[model samples]
Target: MPTYISAVFNKDTRTVEFTADNGDKLIRSGGSLAWLLNNPGNLRPGGKYAKMIGQADTKSGKFAIFPTAEDGRAEKRALLRRKYNDMTLYNAMHTYAPESENDTAAYLAYVRKRSGATDQTVIKDMTDEQFNGMIAAMEQYEGFNAKPETRKERIVHATQVTLSDGARPMPATPVIVRSSNTGEKKVTTNEHGALPTFITRQPGEVIELFLEESGKIGSRIGQFALQQASASLVFARNMMTVGGNSQPHTPTQPSKEKRTPLRYVVQPGDTLASIASRFKTSVDDLVSNNHIRNRNRIYPGHVVWIYGKAPADAANDGAPATPTRSRQASYSVRSGDTLSRIADRHHTSVDALMAANPSISNANRINPGQKITLPVGVEAVPPSAAGSSRRAGNSGNPQTSDRPSLVKPPPETPAAAVRPPASVQARDTRSREGEGHPIAIIPFSQKRAPWVEHAYAQARKWAGKKEAEISRTINFHSELGYGKQFTTLAGSSNAWCASFVNWCLRTAGYAISSPHPYRARSFAADTTRFSQIDEPVFGAVALVGTSHVGFVYAMDRGRPVLLGGNQSDQINFVRFNPATLRYYVPKSYLPFAQKELKETKLDELAATDLNAALGIVVAKKAGDNTR
Candidate 1:
């Protein structure tokens, strides 16, 4: 068994700290965490992080960082304790000792004298309780003039609030700030969607903020602590449209004219199809009810209207609906029972049977007396109805009959009895039916490379932003040491197609060796670092006729779908003719394995399987052929 570890994201430091069961700690930057959270599908089986978190099995206790309300409370408590200790020590030093080289010694002497201690005392040597008593005594000795009760001055903390949907700022949104110690008050956000700095006198002060707009409420509670100056809060609401205008509306009693439809808050990684599947509804119905113009663009915290009554397992408060398990029947394996034979008897496909039992690895192997689940309405074939060929003999050998045998046949008898001429044998071997038959195997190499995923993830973070926003982000990237090449490319008024790709690759841990990293043609001509390939794979850098460059993320009707920057001035997918594809640069880590399988027949393998192997999910649009 592997030890489970929990990771907590420290927004202040922009680092993620992992805690093990034994109290050991490991810290890493927030980039990887952001990638994982944004691209949960990339957490595939056998990946390095997936194994550590035990994602392969739901029963495994290990999980990636998904902070719950309880975890937040515990973190708050820890922050408060540290802040209190630091404040107490700071007051003791500043009040008793002057600013001098012997300040520590003088403070220790004053503490001992004030406490009336005969033994020598040091600040570090005293217990927390004793230190507090000494500080109180010293204050009293000075005629109690410092007002020890209010010795700690309140510090004003600033925070930004935004809508969970699209992470867009909620400027001018009315908010209510309440503190048990400081009292409740109303406030509003500035142009940046930031609340005015509120003062808190000490640590452990719980500050609750509620977003009040158009009579709707979105609340979050947290604590003020030392060394923690700013925070970003996401405000979520059950938004709906009323009188042809979008508004944040809470659940209310249905009027005589209408009944309130159940509300479903969209979560990250949610899609209209997925939400419809969960609620036993249709995507068309969801779009119709929500008046959604773009089905692919729903964001987290956006409240979608479900026109039907909530499922029995669905909570009224927009909790996810508990999935209903399908009915299944168990069957014991018999001698010589193959997965294909079992599926044939139960009227299920081998793939369906395998899906029903995830633990079953080899479809050809099954042990007698081992139990497996079968789809409901399937029954074992009666012995009388099961042909004699299907039965295994007492020796556990399958009987020979009309049914085909599972074992491979012995090699054909040596042709020595009638040996053919070398020329004839050579001609036969050269036939298309012989060794020339193409194998359509999808090798493990077809999966998207980690670097590609990293680059794609970075590109997605900038998707949907305007040119100015993208330019600002590019400038920030340069300041973070992305080099002058990026800064020079971004400073120009020219199209930034190549600069975007360069930025993504640099962020994904790839170094650009092109003499002119700003030009798409430069990447195409860089033969030393990049080798041109005929076929495109996910995450491959693609050049389009020396004018544009982007990452190939999908295929549609054999055309590469480019997910790159400057596509309509934003990161988006643009399908291009295969003929327009000029050069392809494969990631160094993921070299091609025999190029793509050359199967003449498209049905040899499903396109969905190919897409799954490549980790590509092409978004469908009106008149799109990929769908």
Candidate 2:
């Protein structure tokens, strides 16, 4: 059987080549959407037919991706057989290619004309020849048969002519080479539009070459070819002199001033859209600057680099960047005030206060009149209020207050100079080079650890939720700033298992910093944050061969039950082989594992049994954990 093995787009020819298993091929370009997606029936994503065949790219969630033309045709045939089983040809075409989205009358007419069937002809009663003709006719009417306006024929050159001025060989121009022999045949160029290495050292064998439109331009073989037959053809590398350097020379390096990116610490309730608005930049810029794969995965205490200055920065005033939020929102440093004293007085931790303010370089020394943003839920009186209350009540104005003020605090890190830690700077360098893994804002080494139960709880909350509903699907993707990419439920190709995991972790109060953990491999790939374990544990991340991942909610009969998204097209608990599972927990959370298990009464979970096994079944759909 002729089967489509693979397809690849050719940039030089601007075409897609679908190669069959039998070595046959078809080059297509400038065709219909069906042709572009390799979905002959224009089957939308999320359809059971596409899903059952496992032919659709669920991540893109757009169209079914059929590897070969035969596969696409087979899918269409299956659809007709199953969906239009008992319906008449007219009714089937009407429902299949509805008038709302297609030329239904023309489609029906064309299919009937080609198949020699009438409106009363039942799909099940159609002959094999008629059924095949109907499918082919429908595909043609759908515009799969459309071709480009013109195709450029490839040219072959016998000799690679060199132009004078010699640093390197110039690109071969469109010139035709004709054999001077009696055959008078026009030579052809290879796919790259370059001549094959064809010229031999045999004497008196001359080939004439000229521009495509010009008449016989004579060229002597002796002028360019060396006498050695093995040499093939050797043109003087130094002959091209159109502004080319004749002597060995090095180009002067141009000096460029380096622009340092503005470092901003992420705050609670911060989204990429909101941050972009504050910094007067687009979300795209922030994603590019940080190499962020999932814009929604950023959390409080995470550091992001901004290439543009805030709108308030241009005025060069010391005023707060967000004027709407400046009213009594921040605290003014007083004489002899230390970060520790302020943190204690405000009933917040010193680390929390410092994390909320990345501009503070030293915790020990704080200058008087310097503004400090309090942590969320922590309130303080403005300097004006303090002065008024001091005048009204007593002469002594103590910094400590029995009742905390009611005013909301401003942004955690206001527009000020930021000095990132040396570790962050080094990580940033590696991030730009694409060599670094995503950094955890709160490293697992810290006392603040991710609770697996919380992640499990978050996953359970979305149980039975499917991407078939556009609004709910959009909500899932919106967590990572991908809501806009999906106009419809089927329009998204994002495998959201990773997003689900990241979302669950973020909502559970864990922060992932840098390089967006959008891929399933990300969970296992970030060794600094999550540590591998020997056996399964409740709430542990179950990475299944880098393509699928989920939380280990429980163990049944020694098999780990995974709670994850995109499982059978919804959030559900499915059992997998313990042998195929690699479990990882937050590095710092490992110490509390026994406590967590005891507290949750999960100590009796099944132990790992190497003998138990299941065939490796990695689902490749809807951006689940796919490699």
Candidate 3:
């Protein structure tokens, strides 16, 4: 049997970390909100299972709260056995994890592949092993495990625990856990007839456990105790001390090398690369030690553990090391250079490499001649220092220097250089500009319909605000109302992108007749309100495929600049190719805006005056790389 090792919850990222018996660390992030809620199948709480014992609503949101992983997985099996027993695997997946919110086809394919079963196989006809395997595959597809980027997976170890077979079965019984470190806490047994197991325990710690009477929490009737050691758990029936020693264990002998753990509180504008470099370590060490999800996002007060030897002075007093800036480096891509190879060559991470260079949209693909900026604290390798690789390029040329040169920061422009001329500001509608995707002030033409102008103004108001974390925005949720639908949007799904557009349209007095307005494709489906247009116009709704929606701000270089939320996880400018997008304008507004659209080369006309009307200064920068 596989042993359960460790579990950690990161509130900031809303992700959970767990370790398998083979020392493999599994990260539940992105589309794995069900994992964080302990719901393996993303099961709805409103179903018949909600009436079962110990069922409760989540305090954080509308997601169903399962007491344990075992219970959640068991509930998934129960759900499949009860309702989907007769349907084929493919047909069941369509109803269980619908395409309206989930990638149902991908879910079906993963289950079929993992279980070695066909899509036409019925759930009730499968063997026990195949059924369990199919359920495991479904959970894995739901984001229970993080996809490894490299060939060899990194490993970490944690203590393992197992309950003895002789222990009496207890269901819905609240277990009170009292420990020396953390105070007393009550954990109830799951309704799925599984006992709550404890995996995160320190060595040689004696924990007192009490069973509540009448299954009511905090009403202790009988007491039992368990002693926890590394990979060992000894349970006693009666109130008896398993370990002889009552006082905490202490070691009198001192080690030859003084290696004490050190912690550093993150300061503003600090990256994992900078912190690692300060301690003479690598970015991977900092990320693994701290369990950091997004290397680019570290808050001001977060405490990060520094591995290896501490500085002499700081180790004595145990004071946090002072913050200092690390020098940035830049590298020129070689013939066989990849982001992963470069990250391995230097003592940095692929995420750090991407953080330094924002323009790199894909890590797998990069041109040979592209200039790559190394993250802070990483030393860059020059062409000449690359040895044989460098000589091949400059074999005949003698003018190029062999010595490495430092990358210089961009020269700051004077205030006068950025300020628009007085004459331009007087007549230019885009005189004022804010940072990000629609890089200039939103050009709201009076010639458009009143609602179009209203929508433009509404989109402009939220042009710079960003989600604090994934799918988290106070004003957007407040306007849309946190309903059951938003709970299904997890992982890479853009939960609020459509809601942001809906809010903007609704706030501007434009009513959506569709019942499911939160879904992005709904805007394009409502033929009465929206009509597809070939020519992009100001304030037109642009639908990129089916997952995103944003308002067309201006035309720049044959591309339509869009102002939408969830673009790089912020309400900013995003440029989409004209061929890829389906542009739509309100039928009511098309009549009024046609005069502006009559220009044969509307994109060219907007490129010169509409897109260039505003002077821009970057006030803030968005960091997330997702849409």
| TM-scores for every candidate against the unseen true structure | 0.26, 0.33, 0.30
Cα lDDT tens digits, model 3, 1-627, are 322233333444455444333323344555446645567776765565521211212333344445456767887888889999999988998998889877788788888999988989998999888898998898887765543332122222222111111111122334555655555555443211122333333444444544544433332222222223112122212111111112122324322332234555553345788877655558887787666667765533245666543344432211223222334668878787766557534423444466577797665568888888775434564343222321112111000010111111112321111122111121111111211122121111122322333333333333333455323423343344333324433334435667667655544334331323556775665442345666777667788888788877656677987766666555555677888788775433443334446753333223223212222111343462337
- The digit string of per-residue lDDT tens for model 1 on 1-627 reads 112233333333444433222222344443332232222212222222212221211122112342222332233223324333444444544532436533555555565666654334444556666655664454333232332343221223223233211112233445556565555555554322334433223545565665554544443422332113323233322221112221223223322222235555554346899988765568998998776777876543345666554445442221222222223568788887766556534433344466567688765557999988763323343332232221221111110011110111112221112122111121111112223322221111112232344334434454344456656534422322223323432333445677567655543334342324556765654332344555665556788877888876556576766766666555556677878786554223222211332321111223343333223354543565321
Error of 1 at 595 (Å): 4.7
lDDT string, candidate 2, 1-627, tens digits? 333433433333345444333223344655555665477777764444432211222232345557655667888898889889799998999899889877889889989999998999999999999999999888877777565354322211122322211111112223344443322333322111223333333444554433333434333212332122211121212111111112112224322223345666554346899988764568998998666667765543345667644334332121212212212236789997766556434433344465567687455557999999764334563332212221122111111101111111122222212232322332112121223332212111112223343343333333333556423423444443334333333334666666667655644434321122446765554432344666765567788887778877656565777767656555555778878888875432444443454544322232222111111233345655322
* Maximum-TM-score candidate: 2
Better of 2 and 3 by TM-score: 2
Error in Å for residue 550 of model 1: 0.5
Q: Rate the local accuracy (lDDT) of all candidates.
A: 0.42, 0.47, 0.47
Best-to-worst TM-score order: 2, 3, 1
As for candidate 1, its clashing pairs are none
* Candidate 3: residue 233 Cα off by (Å): 73
TM-score winner between candidates 1 and 3: 3
- Cα deviation of 178, candidate 3, in Å: 78
